[model samples]
Target chain A: MMIDFSLYVITNRDLSRNKTIIEVVEEVIQGGATIIQIREKNLPTRIFFENAQTIGKITKKAGIPLIINDRLDIALAVDANGVHLGDEDLPLKYARKVAPHLIIGYSAGSICEARKAEEDGADYLGVGSVFSTKTKIDAGEAIGAKKLEEIKRAVSIPVVAIGGITLVNLPEVIQSGVDGVAVVSSIIGAESPFQATKKFRFTIDYLRKGKIC
Target chain B: MMIDFSLYVITNRDLSRNKTIIEVVEEVIQGGATIIQIREKNLPTRIFFENAQTIGKITKKAGIPLIINDRLDIALAVDANGVHLGDEDLPLKYARKVAPHLIIGYSAGSICEARKAEEDGADYLGVGSVFSTKTKIDAGEAIGAKKLEEIKRAVSIPVVAIGGITLVNLPEVIQSGVDGVAVVSSIIGAESPFQATKKFRFTIDYLRKGKIC
Candidate 1:
């Protein structure tokens, strides 16, 4: 599967301003989020599945790909576009073998892991703790944009930088040669997810093309 | 599928006196465990998948059902007989929809959960921390055999008593009318897993039929 996405938005209910995942997803899509990842670390399975199903409807209506985090079952259950996995989650090869059609995104902290993920048939790579953020507790020590560039060079698959990526540091992260940036708190935590997403979309495009379109 | 296992042995490498999971699985099977659940809470995905595959082979040779604890991907990847889920794991219905051929065991601490699992198509129920033991830290308060009886009555599917079950309490747990007992430390952490399994098998048989032969 060819993964073409920019300004990837990850959903974190705790970071949102009392907005349901559906509301935030709708807002972000209007703001130009090309991809959506439902990353629920603490929800029960039933609620998680329902949320994914509800969000899947919105993302589908907008023609945006829905990515489920750390759960192949939920991804398969809700028929999402892809499933994202970290080091502690299911390995990429197993997920590929089980669901060949779904785009599998692997989280890589180093170049070695990035190369392995590509070899293991991951459609894309999410490389991060890029700027030391608290959104994901186990995201590990901040690897910095320097490491992101190194990893992007090491893997052939599309690399999406994640963790602590805000407007201030997004330029540096974008300049790291990554294909995209996945934001959690920056968009979901903003006063207006729609406006936040529009700004992110503008910044990402501006940085990539060297002009404000 | 008809899950007819009496002695359900759960593998915990940490308590295995440095023995590998494969070693403990082989020992327990020889001693007469009818089913095996590969429960690796801390193992990375690759190693966990490898262990499940290796253990799957042993269980297949012996014609015993192999269940992966809390990971549906690993169970599906290695073609295990089932995947056991707890409150925090993937919900039973989603797993059933994805893998209908695989048995789905659900952990239910109360009758409400047990009845819900049955409605959701769980093949069996693991009702426990039947007694207070250190094997499963999250097994919660020891529900005792009395609660097991109540849960067993509330559901039609087979119920397996787990957590802190020992030979001394085996009669009470069995007398609670549970179909089987899933033991962790009692078997994996025993000095002689084979002998311990033999003892469990004999006791379960004797208690159920009131005869030695």
Candidate 2:
């Protein structure tokens, strides 16, 4: 399946505020989020699996890809379009060997990691906290646009910029030539996830059209 | 952490019949099942996480260990006492390196795999399908008691006999010097999970007392 990484929304139930993760996801997808990643870190296994299946159905029906974060078993259980894994999670080679059909996205913090992921057959790369942000307390130091650009140049696979990304600074991230922008609080945590998603989609389209930031 | 695998009950929700996995688990624990493995392969991620937390809490209060099947993320998320990995799951060495405190168990079908698991710092080995059973369609051929004995001799760590284990065959498995017995249908799928658990517990205790089968 060809995965569209543009305006990828990583779900954060804690940030959803008065809304279930599924509700926020529906709104975001309706507002033109190209991809959805179920990234809840603390939900019990059952809840996470249910949420993934619910969102996966929506994404599948809408022709959007649903990427499960960190849990390959859950991804397989839900028959998701793909899986998104971090450095601390299972290695890419093993994931590829086990689930060759799923599009595997690996988080890379450096040129070496990006190259390694590409060599290991990762379908895409998540590169960032291009800016310092609180969404991930342990996202390490911000890699900045220079490193993001370096990573993009170093790898053949598509790259999606993540971490602390918001509408205000997305232009700079887009300027780094990332294939997509992954957002958390700026969308799901917003007063209206639908509007926030629309704004992000508009900005990405405008920037990608070669408009000056 | 020392894991007591004496009467390990691997949850099979499909075989559970009319009861939730958590409900059957509670009854089994009350009937003296020592270790619990939440092995639901089809549950959504959210439901699995929730079940793990609920079961983890109950097991923690009862002083029993809960082992999550396959997904290390769920094990770490719920602070499970340990994790059980199949042949196709994450490599043992990497799992040990990442989660040093958890008691890791590996399933092995041969002496080489058994010895390798011990060398990789696995806390225990689950050697199985001692008698042909339909529970695991992909469990391959039955290894029988002879192979189980060889596996026990090959690995220094504790060994648990799994696959088609029931109260009727518990004696033969125990006589092979296995530290524990893992059950699926014979307990959870029984007409009364609680009563079945008690019977298996009694049989294990009786065999451990050096009585003839």
Candidate 3:
């Protein structure tokens, strides 16, 4: 796991800046998004490619790499930092052939997938629904903190806990051994996303430091 | 299962017309492509949307519906006939909610996933890697035709054999009791894709008619 969790932000064109998805991404980066994954599953390829291109430029500047979800073509098109693939998406090895050094992330809902992603040369793992979420209707059952700990202990890579994570639940999840939290509606849907990110970052920093920030 | 298994056309973008993908699809439709899934995972949402729009137009003209692969975004974006998702993608239940009337296809590598897919309101199931291929790396151990039979027996829905299925061994696949066959490279990478699809259609017709093409 080359990535250590600080702030894993999943971009949403819907909520956030009410501006271009790219601007919202910039704000998140400004608010301390250490890692960003552009998951615009609905936008046209051109839109995704353009957004990725814009975001890729900024992330490169911010030293944050943008990972596209399930779209190797878009990832390659923009020369983005990397791509995130689910078990059913283009196999990581195949994606690797196309996007060589890009940091490839895999969706690991189970111990089996996490292990496979590691063996397959995944740079990091997005393990989740640390709790059930409406972020994406298809998310697997919340794996619970214990399972997160088990996976965290098992894999040598960084584990980013996703799905329904909020400040209220931050301490428990962090204690469960996750390197960082991947958020959706909580921040993107918030009236003040920057503030929300600050709170999340503050909480994570406090817990990690064993002292309130 | 809403899908007919006599002959199935794996959808392609450029293959819609005057190409091998289209030719194979049309041939299979003529011989009998009971269901057609337009699986172009490469294009952006808009491109996929546009291609699916063209495919939807054509398939509707031919009375055949098209299924988008792992893209509820493009499927809904294009208002295509249906959407197919892999196990690691979104869950069928959620996709069903979003596209109630559209056909929902699920890809499963194990009996457990197939069973889960059925419980999740899946319209059909894609079971595979019956042989290894470059399409999906980290493919499960080749389950072979016999295993397909077992899967067919296990699931009440129609089972479409996928992953590395080609003209060379479709007979054994149908003989194993699969309702349909799904191929990626066989059509996309072929020199004469139109003829290849025609040959597959003829072979399927032969199986149904109790003779070889």
Candidate 4:
């Protein structure tokens, strides 16, 4: 399925200024985040599933799609809109088979991976570590905007740029032709996640419309 | 799906005497392990998926069921025979929905959980820590064979007893009316996994036939 999200805010509870994931997601929806990806790297499976259920309610009420990161089982259990898989996560083909109606997203750091993901039935591609950051220790070195542009051009599926994505670097990332941006620290780590997400939403809208923010 | 297996072996590479999981599985199969459940608690998701693929090939060639522990995604990705989920793992209802044809096993410690699992479409029940041991830190207190028999009577699905099950206690476990036994340290951590598995298999067979071994 083709995905239509623009500003995809990934949840990181540790960086959400002491708010629970549910609270962060509510604020994100209020700030106009088109979609929310629940990315808990260090939670027990049952807790994660419960959290997903709670967050699913908030997102559903706000008319926002909820995407679960790295856990298709949890995503399916909660009937979230989709699941996003990284290089080390579940393979796209099997995920597609397990949940044909659920949107499946694959992470791609190169044009080769991007094309393969699209061919393998990924609804969208999460590309990058476009700029280096401390959010994910294993996010690898930054790929920069040039590589992002090449990968974007290589696939027909939507490409979402991620990692170290802040307001300062978002314009160049948008110019790389990605369909959306997946942010962590820029939104979740901000003093006010709502304000930060609003700024991101406005900037992406301006950039997509070919106007300077 | 009705599961018909006697000796269910769970892989623990750490206790396999320096052998790779594949090698341990080979030995277990040689000793007549009716089914294998790949339980990699520490491997990365991609590596776990790869290991499942390798074990899947072995189980497929041997005409035995391969049950991936706690990872339905990897199980489906490799076309395993089933997936075994614990209390903290994926919910059985969603797993049943995800893979209707595959055997789904649920871990239940009480009669309420067992009946609920069967009602929720679990093909079989893995009931245990039948005896407490150091193998699984979170296995909880030993439920004893009395509890096992109670749980067994509570559900119509096949019950596979797990946790600290050794040949010495195997007879009592069988007398509790379980359909099979799931062993970790008793087989994998043995000096000869094949011999250990063989003895357990033979004992189980003899016990089932109502004969003293």
Q: Who wins the lDDT comparison?
A: 1
Off by over 4 Å in 3: A1-4, B1-213
TM-score of chain B of each: 0.95, 0.96, 0.85, 0.95
Report the CAPRI category for model 1: acceptable
Clashing pairs in 1: none
Better of 1 and 3 by lDDT: 1
**What ranges in model 4 sit over 4 Å off?**
A137-139, B137-139
Off-target runs (Cα >4 Å) in candidate 1 are A1-4, A12-27, A40-54, A108-116, A127-157, A168-178, A188-194, A207-213, B1-3, B12-23, B40-47, B108-116, B128-157, B172-178, B189-191
Candidate 4 lDDT by residue in tens digits, A161-210:
98898899989999888889999988998888899999999999889898
Tell me the docking grade of candidate 3.
incorrect
**Per-residue lDDT tens digits of candidate 1, residues B1-213?**
456768999998898987899999999999999999988885665678888999999989998999998878788888899988887677677788888878888888888888988999998988888888887734678899999999999988999998899999898888888999999998899999999999999999999995522
Pick by DockQ: which candidate is best? 4
Q: Which candidate leads in TM-score?
A: 4
> Candidate 2, which segments miss by more than 4 Å at Cα?
B1-213
Best of the two (2, 4) by lDDT: 4
Per-residue lDDT tens digits for candidate 3, residues B1-213, read: 245655566756453444644455665566456667776655544445556666677777778767777766556545667777775455566567656787888888788888998999998888887877767522466888888888889999988888778878888888888888887677655665556667787787788676753
Clashing pairs in 3: A1-A157, A44-B46, A45-B44, A45-B45, A45-B46, A138-B91, B11-B38, B20-B193, B20-B194, B24-B197
lDDT of 2 at B135: 90
Output the TM-score of candidate 1.
0.78
- Per-residue lDDT tens digits for candidate 4, residues B1-213, read 245569999998888898999999999999999999988886777789889999999988988889998878788778898988877877788778878888899988888888998999998988878998888723567899999999998888899998889989989999999899998998999989999999999999999998863
Task: List model 3 lDDT by residue over A1-213, tens digit each.
Answer: 255467888887765656667767777787887888887766654556567777889988888867788876566556667777775466666556545677888888888889998998888888887888877723588988888888888799888888888898888888887778888788788777777788888888889987743
Look at candidate 3 and tell me the lDDT of residue A198. 83
